[model samples]
Target: MLTIDSLSHRLSSYLEPTQINRVKRAYYYAEQAHAGQYRRSGEAYITHPLAVANILASIHMDHQSLMAAMLHDVIEDTGIGKAAISHQFGEQVANIVDGVSKLAKIEYETQAEKQAKNFQKMAMAMARDLRVIVVKLSDRLHNMRTLGALPAEKKRRIAKETLEIYAPIAHRLGMNDWRIEFEDRGFAAMHPLRATRLHASLQQVRGNRKTLVEKIQAAIELRLQRESIDGLVIGREKHLFSIYNKMRSKHKSFKEIMDVYAFRIIVEDIDTCYRALGAIHNLYKPKPGEFKDYIAISKENGYQSLHTVIIGTQGVPIEVQIRTKEMDELASRGVAAHWLYKSSGDDDSASAGSYDRANRWIKRLLEIQQHTNSSVEFVENVKIDLFRDEVYVFTPKGEIIELPAGSTPVDFAYAVHTQVGNTCVACRINDRPAPLSQQLESGQKIKIISSEKSQPNPNWLNFVITAKARAAIRHYLKNQRHTESVELGKRMFMRALTNNNLQFDQLNHDQITGLLEKTTSESLDEMYESVGLGRITALTITSILLPDSDENRDGTGITPISIESPDSLLISFARCCRPIPGDPVVAHLSTGKGVVVHREPCKNVSDLRSKKESLSDISWSPNVTGEFLTIIRVEVKSERGIIASLATRIANTGTSIEGIQVDERDAENSVITLTVAVTSRVHLANVMRSIRNMRSVTSVGRPKT
Candidate 1:
């Protein structure tokens, strides 16, 4: 029964006569294009597009969006080209239409990949023009509304995707109304029996709920009247999906979930909003710790409201939300509210903030896309960023930072900027030193400690929840490996050149080019990377460059490279030997890992010695700085607080305990294994001597590999 006539009449509310006429023309064009096409329900396909346009009209979307909604399927279903739409409408409308068109299926991809690719392409479109996604969302909503005509398997698939992706997208955009609809409808289609039971239960309680809500709504109304506050009072309507989600998440029964009566108080201005809140609080005593002032600090989606709970008649809890009319609409329509106020000349700073917030989110998605390894990963990261319960923390300067619940300092650092996250080595919460992995809470102030030598640890991926942090860390590590590989390869090649009585700086361009060609490397850096990764040997490059220099490969020819910093990406100290500064160490060429340092006397080094190509002499510089992990065993009597004593002693020696484990030796004694941080052998010796002198300590020695 829906038609373009009703939509056109509604459009006349704000749109000019010319815009309405253009929309009508687009509708008629789409209708003619789909003359005989029918949906699975046997209804004319034109009805679907008309219904989609109606939904956009409800949001008061731009006239162009409405036109695109009408002709969105024309390009994909009717085989009409974008050129045709462009010739009819303007380029903007045509582009929106093309963007909303379903992509032709790409061959040779699995179903998951196909879905990821589709979402990736759609996200790019969303970044181009926000209207494209708004139109596509409206189209999806219409399809979801009439989903009963779909087959069971197909219906479930569509419902699942809606709940997983579309619903979250709506929530992220602050489209509360559309999000609730999407979730409820998708829930019904996915789980028919559960939805039916929940619906029936709600119907049974509707009478009592309405009565209670009305009684409390009247009390708030009378209080506001007495206070001379002009406000609109309305009882809150509970959505089925929200109710079900509450029951599942809170593990409560239907009665418990429905116990609290809810209402909304919409005032004329911000001052009146606060006045109305005071009036309501005077009528009913407010519950402590149940108030949130979101108006002062808007949510990430720019939702603003003052929420509080009060004890009402018969001691029953009443939940209320107070806001201005604009806030109320912005809460529901979200970014789309920008257009709702556009033609009315009501585009204020608040609406602009909401629109800009949504744009920032979309921009972040594009940034994550650049660093992601695959479309699947990008979509997964987007999904991670979509659903978040925010915690508001503060910076040292009193600026508020909002992050997802359970976010750590690393997540916060990346939220600030990529460079901050990459270089941050420590954190202070509330002016006290705290572990970087400690979960942050609301209202706490954070300070990040950064060092130029610090790099993002691969282990950060284990705890970082934000997409930006994960992507940036991965991107940095990927680039860092290449740089480290090049550096190591350069040193190895220089050593080989030195042994052959050749200076690398003196090599002619022709000679370097010939060597690169022989090594199948297109550039000098490529040859370095190949050698660094162990894909090709440094000796091979030297042999090819100087064919008569085979005799230069002697043990004495290899020079020792000073490893000032073992923390470099390519130079890692082997855990087996736990090499610290002042230890005689050798660089073991490890494929894919570059150089790994092992103590000379380590048993593992003896095995690697047979492969002379893998061996390169190395040593620590006197100025070597940074903590190194080493294991030490302490034989101690089982005295009370013996482990505590050892920890205190280690700290007194300026050595930090990374780990502590107890090994029960007998009834009266225990072997304490301590993994401590040390600068060099002298530092370790000082720590050992400090521990050995303790009364509980019988002996102290480093564990040899």
Candidate 2:
């Protein structure tokens, strides 16, 4: 009833007879390997591989990839060895199988961890051979299709994994078809009740709109036909998950949302695509500021299309995408489109360039993996790249450098060349001096100014947002610690001589060890390094050597001061905030800076405590004090003159704006959050009440504990 020859009849345009024979052999071998095994659905386990292979074939995979997909699970699930597969098939097929098997072996304690690690591994695999992810995605697609056989928890886990791992990969690769199907299937599996309800609602909408979509398609087709344009027109409903997300995020009802239906036109070439676009605009009114021509500058994942949203019949908004057939294939299948293009005898120069660009990140991955001690670090670094929204900024020469969104000029400098980053003193974006932390927007031209004496600053660690920038800063700091520690140690030892404690130059290495051993430091070099790093305070050691001498320190007081009650305690508000009654509070005491109160959950405090153990014990005073000032966080939507309006509100209650910090530098939805200090509980409450009564205030509350 079924034969490779029969399948070849349909797929021969892509797969040769010899290729079909090889797949048949691989399939039979896989069947034998999984002989008596059965899936939870009680079907032969071998059917799963065949299904995956069929999915690959539908996408027109090459001979070796199809063969590898057929045997991908054998080594992982059926006890088949890699050596045996290598001996049977050539190394190419075995290598792909081994990559999949290795990925399958990396397990984790939690599903979330596993999913993150899996994406990491998938990225690594793609770096090595792009085909690995193609097969893996196809395998995931088949699993998603038959996911009903799994238990509810398993379904949710798998669907969530698809959403996090597979769907994003599909999007990054510009595989729109796979992305839509994967998301829709995952949404259905993960939220069956919600999915069912949305489906019923969509069906109700479709019932009244069937003729409407048909009429729109017919009109567009007639126009295209009149123009003698060769293209394929297809209509699509918006994916349910996407609709649900938009509804939830924008706080709009389903009925209030437009652009539910989209029509895509696939043409033969780029010229034809624009021609079709022109014809559509002539037929219907094109919405302003919604047209995008991705074909000219393709997405990083190699997706290219011309998209426009138009106002159609009955005041309905319809989205239209136009692209060449090759663009559509790549848009639909992403990297899998490479296999199809290769099978169809097209030159792969463009696809190869994309692969090369993506693979360039592998060296960085291996670099990150080497420095990282655990999967958590690996996951964190990889996530920076995974969900990164790209910003395309131009160099002085007009060449584009794409960095993660929110990237600063520091990142741009580093991207230009490591030397530029190392020597960068300042930057001018669009010929205007901007802060090093200023987020570069699209179409901005950046120029980095470097000086021969320039060196990386410790503060750059805060502003540089790219993984490469972060890694470089970390590497520079590591090296600087060794160099600075030696210099600081020499200075401290020389200073100790003045206190009549120890003759530093005359003392042998062993004596220095004795001093270091008291602090649990391994050696004299480490002791000096600690002093140099500011990890071990020089004053603390000086006190150990000279117990009674009051020394004039170069900077902050050398004596480690404690925050005990004084005759007139020098209490100051923490930089984390100026605390008030309702605010979550914490305190920081700098030797010379005095006590600084911060919002307990402030970014600076949270970051300091997690990374710097010395800062962790800082907490609030249970007893309320009229002298202690506190700060509250407020998030308000941006409006005309809202900042002035808010300041007026706070001023109305007689509150002092101790430190009003606006998130003006960020280009996201404008949220004017300011920290105002109040003298007492009553003062803070009054200020909050005044602010809340203002028309612009959206949410006002103390920071969560």
Query: Whose TM-score is greatest here?
Result: 1
Question: Per-residue lDDT for 1-705 in model 1, tens only?
Answer: 777887888889889999899889999999999999999999999999899999999988989999999999999988999998999898999989888885333222338888888888887888889889899889889989999888998788888888888899998889999999999999999899999999999889987777777778787888888898888998887888889888999999989978888889999988888888888889999999998888888988889999999999898998899999899999999999998888678757888888898999898898898888788888788888998778889989999988888899999999888899999999999999999999998889999999987889999999988888889999999899999888778878888888777898898999988998888998889899887777777777788877876565544456536777657877888989888898888878788877788888998988876656467777787788888998998998998888877888889998989999999979998988888889989999999888888987888897777
* Cα lDDT, all candidates: 0.86, 0.72
TM-score of 1: 0.91
- Give candidate 2 regions above 4 Å deviation: 1-13, 105-119, 258-260, 348-350, 360-374, 404-411, 418-426, 436-440, 450-467, 470-705
lDDT of 1 at 294: 89
Q: In model 1, what is the error at residue 375, expressed in angstroms?
A: 3.1
The TM-score values for the models, in the order shown, are: 0.91, 0.71
lDDT tens per residue, model 2, 542-658: 666666867643322222222222111223455444455445555443443223456666777767666542331233345544444455667776667887888887777776676
- Tell me how far candidate 1 lies from the true structure as C-alpha RMSD in angstroms: 3.0
